[model samples]
Each structure stands twice: as C-alpha cells, then as structure tokens.
Target: MIYKVFYQEAKDSTPRREQTRALYLDIDAQTELEGRIIARQLVEEHTAYNIEFIELLSENHLEYEKTHADFSITEF
Candidate 1:
C-alpha cells in the first residue's frame, strides 16, 4: 500500500494558506504501521520534520497520481 505523508519543517510554524502544501511524500509499505514507521525514520535521518498526518493511498492512488504531477514513492 502507498501512504501519503504531510509534514512541515520542524523549525517552521504551521504553514499559511498560501503555502500550497506541506512537503509531500509517498511511501510504499506492506501496512499502515510500517508506512508510518518508515516515514518517521526517513524524516529523522534526513531532516527535521513534524508529520502532520499519514493517509492510506492504495484506494485513491490513481486519483493521486493524476492530481500530483510530481508524485513518487519515497524510498527508505
């Protein structure tokens, strides 16, 4: 399954309306728990980010792909 993670830089406050979107990430994992874990690990290792939420995308993956021109599955 694919999980979409919305996050913001740890040093930054909540984004304003004009922010468009928080830094976006899509991770492929066997389950929701695994997806969350990997996302956290990647963020912790690469940059400081506060995860806003995680959404399961396997159901809406097609729509997501069409909507986000830069969509990709993040590697852990």
Candidate 2:
C-alpha cells in the first residue's frame, strides 16, 4: 500500500525556527500499523524532524501523476 506521511518540523522555543514540510512516501506493507512503522523508521533514519501526522493516500499504487489545463470563457 501507498501512504502519504504529512509531517511538520517540531516546534521549538528557539531563536531560529524551521519551516513546515511534508513528505510523500510509497510504503509497501500489509497493514496500517506496519505502514506507520515503516514511515517512522524512514523519517527517523533520514531526517532530524518529528512527524505531525501520517495519512494514507492510496493503496496498491506505485506512482503519482499530475496534469494541468487551461480554458477560456466569454459572456455577453
């Protein structure tokens, strides 16, 4: 299954603050619990920030795509 982990930088009472960021991960797991574990591990190993939320975007999907289009309308 694929999951979108929405995490933000941990708030700190410091002079310099970090901006909020989100990460999208394609997790391969059987259950939600497994997915969360994988996501947490990935973040812990790769990043130095804490996660705020973990959301499931889709299941059995490997890739994500986006498209853009433009249209014109006229009224009299």
Per residue, candidate 2 scores C-alpha lDDT tens digits across 1-76 of: 5455555565353323255455666677989889889887888777766676676655332233112212121111
Predicted candidate 1 versus true structure: per-residue lDDT over 9-64, tens digit per residue: 55467654444333345676787788778877876788766666766666566476
All candidates' TM-scores? 0.59, 0.59
Best prediction by lDDT: 1
lDDT of 1 at 56: 67
* Cα lDDT computed for each candidate against the true fold: 0.64, 0.57
Regions of model 2 farther than 4 Å from truth: 10-19, 59-76
Clashing pairs in 1: none
Cα distance off (Å), candidate 2, residue 22: 1.4
Candidate 2 global CA lDDT score: 0.57
